[model samples]
Target chain A: MAYSNKVLDHYQHPRNVGSLDKDAADVGTGIVGAPECGDVMKLQIKVDESGRIVDAKFKTYGCGSAIASSSLATEWLKGTTVDEAMAIRNTQIVEELSLPPVKIHCSVLAEDAIKAAIADYQSKQERLREAGAPES
Target chain B: MRHVLLRLIDPFETLGLPATMDLDAATLEARYLELSRTAHPDRNAEVESDAQVAMLARAAAINDAFRTLRDPWTRAQALCERLAPGVVAATAKLSPEFLAGAMELAEAVALAERDAAEALAERIRRALAAILADIRAALTHVDARSAARLLNEARYWQKAGADLRQKLRA
Candidate 1:
């Protein structure tokens, strides 16, 4: 299928295409795979003390549409609150990318990656908070 | 002919074979050839035009069934889907560690020298063999969930292996 201009642009020049310190207390990493097409996507977000995503990155091994979807996701994640990031939907990505019906799953994979990353970040914070809490 | 053309038939049903993972290749081939000969549209040239259309559709469907069943991987996939409808849509939840490792393997393949890529490709092949065995066992037991999961994993390894081989060829 022919990719839209936006999809092609993100694919050719993907933004935030790398990794953060996954072990860091503030960084949340999410790795997801699409079973239909055997596509794998890893999306990570680093939240600051105020819970705003300060940075995002990703590495995807799949088709151009998958890469573009993740790349667009990371771009959206940065500067958004974790809750805001969670609200990001696959439909928005589809609209922005003009992905065909067949490639809609690629956008869904990206949405799952975003939620997974946010969930990881929240769980890490929960653990850190518990560790510093006063004894009952 | 009209009814046959209208309904969707699974590969096993189309080939008039038992829906089992342990299909005999020789038997499958024999069945496919026999079905193809009967389904060939040219043999229906003397029939009405609509009958010819049905014949053409049947011939195409037979070809598709053969293609889907000939490969062990796809055959297993078809069986799993037939046994557990909507299982394919569930998207098997692979572990995060496995996904991470797969990404790293893809990266390694991209950067590896010819010899290293070959080694990695061989490793993937071995892993695929084990997964295929597991899939066969799962299907034998009618464990659609396990079969679906294994098939999903197999697709990743298959793609990786193909990529590595292409790189080596380059």
Candidate 2:
């Protein structure tokens, strides 16, 4: 299928392609795959004490659209609150990427990755909080 | 045998095969060839163009069925979707650890020296073999979930192997 200029541009020059420290207390990591196509995507975010996302990165082993999708996700993620990041939708990503119907799933994968990473970050905070709770 | 199977046949049902990861290669090949010959449009009388077109579509579907069932990896991937259609979400949701391992491997592959590439290939091959064995055992014991897990793990190794090959070639 012929990709739109936006899609081709993102595919050609993806942004924030890499990963973050998944084990860090403030780092949230998300990994999602597309069942329709066997594509893997990893998205990571680093949040500060105020819950504002400070950095984001991604690594994808997938098609151009898949790579572009996650790359775009990272770009949107930086500087957003975790809640704001959670609200990012696949349709918005699709609009940003000009993804074709077939590649809508790529955007969905990116959305899923964002939510997963946020969830991971929240859970880690919960664990830290639990560990630090004063003894009864 | 061919005419009877022409009616609304799913790929697995067309091959008269179970929707499982483990398939006998010999049986798949034999059935594919048998059906190919049976479904050939030329085998139908040349009287009507309509019949020929219908036969052609059927033949194409049969070839597609064969393609879907032929590869072990794809067979499992397809079977997962088939057995649990609503469970598309269950497939390919890799873990953070798995992703980390994959990223590291990808980085290694990017800068792999000759010996390093070969070593990584060997490791991926071994991992593939182990996963296949687990899949076999899982299927034998009717452990579908474990079988899916094994197949999911195998996907990583398969990609790693492919990436390594491409890198080495470059």
lDDT of 1 by residue, B87-168 (tens): 6456477889888877877787778897677678789989999999998998889998988888877778877887888887
DockQ score of the complex predicted as candidate 2? 0.42
Question: Fnat per model, in the order given?
Answer: 0.75, 0.31
**Per-residue lDDT of candidate 1, residues A1-136 (tens digit):** 7889999999899999998999988899999997656789999999988889999999999999999999999999889999899899999999999999989999999999998998888888888888995321
What RMSD does model 1 have?
Answer: 3.6
For model 1, state the Cα shift of residue A118 in Å.
0.5
Least accurate 10 contiguous residues by lDDT in model 1 chain A? A127-136
For each candidate, report its DockQ versus the true two-chain complex: 0.76, 0.42
